[model samples]
Target: MQHLDLDFVRQQFPMFQTELGQKIGFLDNAGGSYVAGAVIDRLTDFYTNYKVQPYGANPISNRAGEAMELGRRTMAELLNVSADLITLGASSTQCFNTLSIACTPLVAKGRSAAAGEVIVSEQDHESNIGGWERLCQQQGATLKIWPVDPESGELALEDLEKLLSNKTAIVAVTHSSNIIGTINPINEIAALVHGVNAKLVVDGVSYAPHAWPNLDVLDADAYVFSTYKTYGTHLGVMVVREDFLQELAPQCHFFNMPYPNKRLDSAGPDHAAIAALAGIGDYFAALHDHHFAGKKGLPLHRKARAVAALMNQHENELCAYLLENLNDLPVRIFGRKTIEQREANIALSSPKISSKALADGLAEYDIAAKNGHFYAYRLLQAMGVADMNDGVLRISLSHYNSLEEVERCVAGLRAMLG
Candidate 1:
């Protein structure tokens, strides 16, 4: 298809057919996206048929093991990376925590030549920052802040350069800000971090939903994202580069050290959630088939890339429309006023009404949105937001969201602001 077929795209998600779902315009997609029908089917099938302990002697166990392996492989395939590099956990926060523990030798005081330093961006979600902070505290290592432009809430490459030194062991940041919606230049950041012999860890939770992570090109030592935000089950995927993996202290059981994928997987999340991830691959394949021609021979990751292009294009249009309308309103948009270098996600505050009040008004109109610092508390605090609790109203979007939904959001905001 020349453009994303919105009707066909919306149908893949079962939520749009429900009573409340039909009534409400779902703009709070950054929190979590509605599960695709394929994902639901796989999840239900797993629970009903083979919910036994996997990789055991029994046939059911073998089948369960195969299903779980397929799920893991699907994630690796989507990212175009080796399956052994992918580690699944409860959530991205858990993954990052495990990764930090794994890096104890690199960050700890006597273990390294000097008390190692770590840099975390001020614009990052707490999931990416807090784990490293706690790790540094325990290890007596220095934790440097890569400050954001207080007015724009955007991180500067120059600030990160100043923070990077030979003492820097790790530089953790987000692929995109949940509140500001700005997409950081990961490649450039990676180059700078690598130049100083520091490893890069990117939290891709917000960016993955809008644009699938191209791990093939992203030069980070580690990358993490949540499946729940990508229209699948709740699971965090962490992909560690082989060289980087060897540098970290083993995070798993002694016997499990041989297994590359299990090295950083401390939290063995639900088996069904792992099995259900194959459905995300299924969902993307279906979209690719519907939109493009003769991609059957192509690999899953390449097909996903093609499908993501369509999704990104459609979302950019919706975002542009939303920004244009909101520009005339009495609201202060936190990030770039245009769609450039941003996702469809948006955050704003209005002088006429509190963010909480604006959110409440939108709820009356059946438009889904919420107001909070959204775990980007440091960024909002730097931006001079008075109340972190009532930070800003975030209207996050997904591929299934339509122009009509954005219009409803704008109209609701107009009513409340006026």
Candidate 2:
């Protein structure tokens, strides 16, 4: 029965203190979230004090190296996974691309015993689909689509069943659709994918912002999410299961190849960004302490899950309120009309007004919603949207978002639709 303290939550983000941030109702969180003040502090500290090459015999270099390692270890702790299993990259797209290339050894001609097959979902963003498609083509492997219901934009579990076979080597899908907002059954999908002896690679970019990832129970061979979307610095965090990682060819330099964590890191990301990740852990710990009185001693991931429950509850209430109010409007909601089986993210378009026009109108109200394909072009196309460029108007919420913000958005939509 512990409700999230919105005031306390908003205080943690420095953006809310600014004039422009206070004026705008930011509903574009699906693209990226505001960085926490703690994260900013960490980034600043790293640049100010230890802005040199890491791990050298010099004292300053050692401090820099230690800071980056702490950041890496903290992220692993946040996900309840081993540090060696996590890979940090500039973006999830880059992580997936590196992974796809690393997978070449599994699918390339004369690389493996069979011509491998890779299955991608129509419900996923291009970040999860395109790389695998190109890999399949390059390797002379078959590529299969797990189609969504054209009308509903829901991917059927039965359709996925048909795609699994002995030839399948990889199945790439989203943990939740960035545009559709529906949370896919990744655990069930993992079970099915593993039955065919194929590795499951999940893009958790959309899901992690709403719910901090728990890799301990999830059976996915690799799970990827963007830290920038999770109130941290801009970076992609990919956790590869030890066994699956051992099978892929290393993407790093020969000297770094021996390190399992560095194997998928094709290009080293910003040092300060990596160090800033420690702040995300700090932010979560602060939230957990504020909400839960006596469980301060719980592990980092446990604390994160506790905090995530409150966040999900607050976001779902706002989402349901927005959906109910929009019921009278002419806009066509793309995913579940209710909050059931969906994140706070919602996408809709209307024949009465163009998506761009609606977005522009909301801007008049100082609302920060957007209209576009949002990189889920295939999903929008499958759902029969006419203008892929304009796509659907998206209202993606974060924990820091308030009911007042939701009201402002609903009011904007009502005035525009009417």
On lDDT, the candidate that comes out on top is 2
RMSD of each candidate? 1.2, 1.3
Q: Report the lDDT tens digits of candidate 1 across residue range 1-418.
A: 4799999998998898899978899999999999999999999989999999999989999989999989989989999999999999999999999999888889867435577899999999999999999999888888999999999999989888888888999999999999999999999999999998999999999999999999989999999999999999999999999999999888888899999998887868999999999999999999998888766777999989999989999999999999999999988999999999999999999876899998999999899999999999999999999999999999998989988888899989888877
Compared with the true structure, all predictions reach lDDT values of: 0.92, 0.93
Displacement of the residue 350 alpha carbon in candidate 1, Å = 1.2
Clashes of 1: 0
Error of 1 at 100 (Å): 0.8
